[model samples]
Target: MSKPEFNSLNAIFINCTLEKSPRVSHTSRLIDVSKGIMERENVSVDEIRFIDHEVPPGEKPDMTEYGWENDEWPELFKRVMKADILVFATPIWLGDKSSVAKKLIERLDGMSDKTNEKGQAIY
Candidate 1:
């Protein structure tokens, strides 16, 4: 069998900063630098600021099914599943990752069992 072709890679950068858009986020700036380098190598990049969206906290694939009035995790998760690379950008708080970062991680754990078309675990 022939080897699989590697045309390009898709990356999703999830900024888990506490601050919203238009606000200064050191973590986000760092992500931008990395994003530029990846783009130079022909990688398709997508960014998501966790704070800007209303993503209710829950340990499930879709929080809406868990009684959340609205959830953005499902949509964001879709992007994550489609990407070849996942980048979480968050500032260190008290020697630990930010809350947004933790939340994203937990939410991701909800889908830890997810697999790609080839049945390989996404994580």
Candidate 2:
């Protein structure tokens, strides 16, 4: 079989640092390294610092009740759906993934049954 052909490969790096403001995060730096590798391969890269956004913790995929598509998590999910690769970068905290990282996973879990325009599973 031949290798898959892609016009462009998009990657999203979800940085799950606990910092509340725009502070330098080690997790983000690690993502930068990975991003550089992807860039060398001609893949578009996008980074999202979870701590910088007000993403609430829940199993609801889209935040429609709270003003549909107005929440950051849903907007971020949109970007994730369009990407070919996804990287979840987070610093280990107390022998476990950061709280923000766990929360992001929970939010994404809600989209496990979602489908794309072509009726393919987004997860």
Candidate 3:
């Protein structure tokens, strides 16, 4: 096995289902479809089931700094940072995405002055 080229396209999919793993997630099935399409195009795809991790809610990049003892977003954010694309998969309820999804979006939006190698803002 060898490292992918620096220019290789990569994507990260965050499944914001409230349901834990070992259980079926229709949204994830939908992600599988998109993942397959990207894979066919030679894109590396990484999947993260958000519910399985302990990511507290906060506007800061790291909730731990905001008095949280444990925040998984820092580690998760690393994955988000490394990807060329981020696909957030969320289940809709009453015509709105799940709370978890909303929180995730907020966190992403709250991203501070971090930019990619191209000098483009990552949000």
Best lDDT goes to which candidate? 1
Q: Residue 2 CA error for candidate 2 (Å)?
A: 13
Winner on lDDT between 1 and 3 is: 1
Model 1 spans > 4 angstroms off: 1-7, 117-119
Candidate 1 global TM-score: 0.88
Q: Name the lDDT value of residue 14 in candidate 3.
A: 96
Question: Model 3: runs farther than 4 Å from truth?
Answer: 1-7, 115-120
Off by over 4 Å in 2: 1-7, 64-70, 117-119
lDDT score for candidate 1 against the true structure: 0.89
Clashes of each: 0, 0, 0
Candidate 1: tens digits of C-alpha lDDT, residues 32-108: 99999888777899999999999888788888887889998888888988899999988996899999999998999
- How far in Å is the alpha carbon of 121 misplaced in model 3? 2.9
TM-score of 3: 0.85
Per-model CA lDDT versus the true structure: 0.89, 0.82, 0.87
Every model's TM-score: 0.88, 0.83, 0.85
Question: Native-vs-model 2 lDDT?
Answer: 0.82
Q: Rank the candidates by lDDT, best first.
A: 1, 3, 2
Error of 3 at 13 (Å): 0.6
